[model samples]
Target: MKKIFVLDTNVLLHDPQAIFAFDDNEVIIPAVVLEEIDSKKRLADELGRNARSVSRLLDKMRGEGQLHEGIPLPKGGVLKVELNHKSFIRLQEMFGDVTNDNRILAVALNYRLEQEDLAASGTVTAAREVILVSKDVLVRIKADVLGVQAQDYLSDRIIMSSDIYSGYVTLFVHPAVIDEFYTYRYLAVEALQLPVQLNPNEFVILRDEMGSSKSALLRVSMDGGKLEPLYLSNDAVWGITARNAQQRMALELLLNDDIPLVTLNGKAGTGKTLLALAAGLMKVEDEHKYKKLLIARPVVPMGKDIGYLPGEKDEKLRPWMQPIYDNLEFLFDTKKSGDIDKILMGLGSIQVEALTYIRGRSIPGQFIIIDEAQNLTKHEVKTIVSRVGEGSKIVLMGDPEQIDHPYLDSISNGLTHIVERFKGESISGHMTLEKGERSKLAQLAADLL
Candidate 1:
């Protein structure tokens, strides 16, 4: 039973290649959707990039056949534009206005009605079922009220926007066990001794029965952290280096070229982004493991909006990227702000870009960092990830608990979605950092909050 998918303008704006994502299913792009895309084509951001890509894709399909009627897609699907006037009439009667979103909804509702009529006939049709797919939650709810089957486009990534792991934990181990490990340097365990919910790369602070002189560290190997790795280096991102046991494990995971996708989730002020940036810089800039260090992050406003600042693009981006700059300054030990700016200028090979311009371009052979990923929608995150070309490593870092998007909660953010989706994947890995190394005040606030 092949279904007819009526795509909303937001879906296309969220992902330009969304038409091809529904394999073998008939995709209907309402005329209103095209109009909306055209309207957004002039914006200089992700939305504009998607709009332009959609235009180029449709233009290329025009050479094959008529899009108004129907065209065969290379991926074995039918692409067509819905130009029915009845949809407008029905929309005007029901909603009283031809707003872009409502018009798109009308197109979907009209198609659904047509599908029912065709279903009554004895002849089977290619589109017996109609599915209105959009990223807007309210739109989907409205479609349900109109007696139409509507769904959110979720083909890009897995994991709900919430339920992402935070890297800190207080583990309860026996007093004798804690004392034994502190004295022996390694704890020999035969079975799973810790909590079942512990994720890889998570830090655990073991407390005695009396809760005193406990150790804080990372769990290097599976099976209750018994199999700790030998540490080779103490030089780490922050002043606090990964303990001998944690250092070896970090190096193993960081240097593995086979594992291209890595995620680090922690509270604000934790060394999640700094550690990832440090590891990336070390690998790409110091070790030459990658060709370039390409850093990007969502331009989400933290706290009150700064409005628009005056300057060139880079200068404008500097305010939003101040956190990134802080990390760079700390890593390079630039005592003065002017010296840090000079270093950033001198490091021509390192590209710090905004996530807005990543669409439609394929990036390969680079270490990409997507900071503050929790702000991105699942569709937006997919658009960024799909642009990864061959031989590229992508890392997503964010604090899921500190999401700022009005539509997205902790369960619907991109960071949580990526973590949940890639959990079982062998080539991908994730860690939740618990210790807030930024400062005592920051850590206290995170804990209290």
Candidate 2:
């Protein structure tokens, strides 16, 4: 049976296109929701952008028919602007205030009783299902108390975090194929005899299944034309060698000039930021492929509030960008406490900026590294990528488990979103570093604590 979905304000803010998601179901927007959206429309964040889009969509739709009476939706559903159910009946007594949430609840309750009355009077066959969709957890709980069916708005959410693309696979191929791969230095992708088609640039560990101790680490060619050996080098990248297979895979993409976009995923202490920085320095300073090296990370509020930050841009960013500086110090091998500052001052082409300030600029001829990228939203990531100039490489690295953004999770953050969407593209590559190389204590803390 068709259902009536009462959308909360947050649902529209989370995704402006959410109204069209419910197929063949009537979508009723409470007048309070529009009021809330209107209040948020003047803000500066992504929520404000979504609020504007929602308004534009509604205004465009209003031209078709009267939204209050109900309008035809594309997928055999009705979109209605519910204006009359503003005051609460018993909900006002229970909640003590007719707040926006309670007012929305009143609308749903009013619909339920009206539909039930019509069904009881034989005006309709049966009462239609009424569901309140919201992204707020507390609202859903309150809805349950008020005897309303509520669910999370999850059309944009990725289902499983554990099932995210790891960008590599292990295969136990026949011993002869391994030997041929070694001799020829490349093998046909068709000879993998795999269950499914491998993504371009995906790494594979081919172990000899004949009970022999022989193996080779190969990567799927960019065109899926062949399986080729990795550019595994014993040479250290700014004093850090590839400690494991995943790191080597990460470096292969990092150092490769062909792949312009790369994403690295791992837990803390896995060297995601360090490795990307090392490669960025190599390409920009050593190889001279890019004119400058630009590093930026989202300024997440953790130790103190951003408003409480006291200083000019550089001084204020000292705390958040310290982690990046620490990695740089490690790469530059700065022994003294203030030596990193000297090194940074000497590099005329290096830029350490915040993601907030990096927007609206055409960044080209630079190697850009975005650290802690999991804290970003999809629209934020899209904006960042669009700012990349004609000849630059962008690396997005983060630990999915350590996300600080409240609305994001392991699978829904911008880092994982880019990994999933860019896997098949030739210019993109990904690596998930499992091992923590920071220290034994840090690894233990990450695992157990």
| Predictions in order: lDDT | 0.73, 0.87
Q: For each candidate, C-alpha RMSD in Å?
A: 7.2, 2.5
Candidate 2 residue 428 C-alpha distance from true site, Å: 0.3
Report residue 278 deviation for candidate 2 (angstroms): 0.8
Task: Tell me the lDDT of model 1 at 339.
Answer: 81
Error of 1 at 392 (Å): 12
Off by over 4 Å in 1: 73-77, 117-127, 158-238, 241-262, 269-308, 311-315, 324-370, 375-396, 400-429, 434-449
Instruction: Tell me, by TM-score, which candidate is best.
Output: 2
Candidate 2: C-alpha lDDT: 0.87
Candidate 2 weakest lDDT stretch, 10 residues: 300-309
Summarize candidate 2's per-residue lDDT along 1-449 as a digit string, tens digits.
99999999988987899889999999999999999999989876777788999999999999999999998888999999998663386887788876899889888888887888999999999999889998777888988888889998878876476679898998887899889988999998876668767899999898888879899999998998789988757578878898988988999999999999999999899989889998888888888999999999988732123556788878888888999999888898888999988888888878898887887789888899999899988888999999999899999999888987756778778888889889989999999999999999999999998
Please identify model 2 stretches exceeding 4 Å from their true place.
Answer: 84-89, 92-97, 301-308
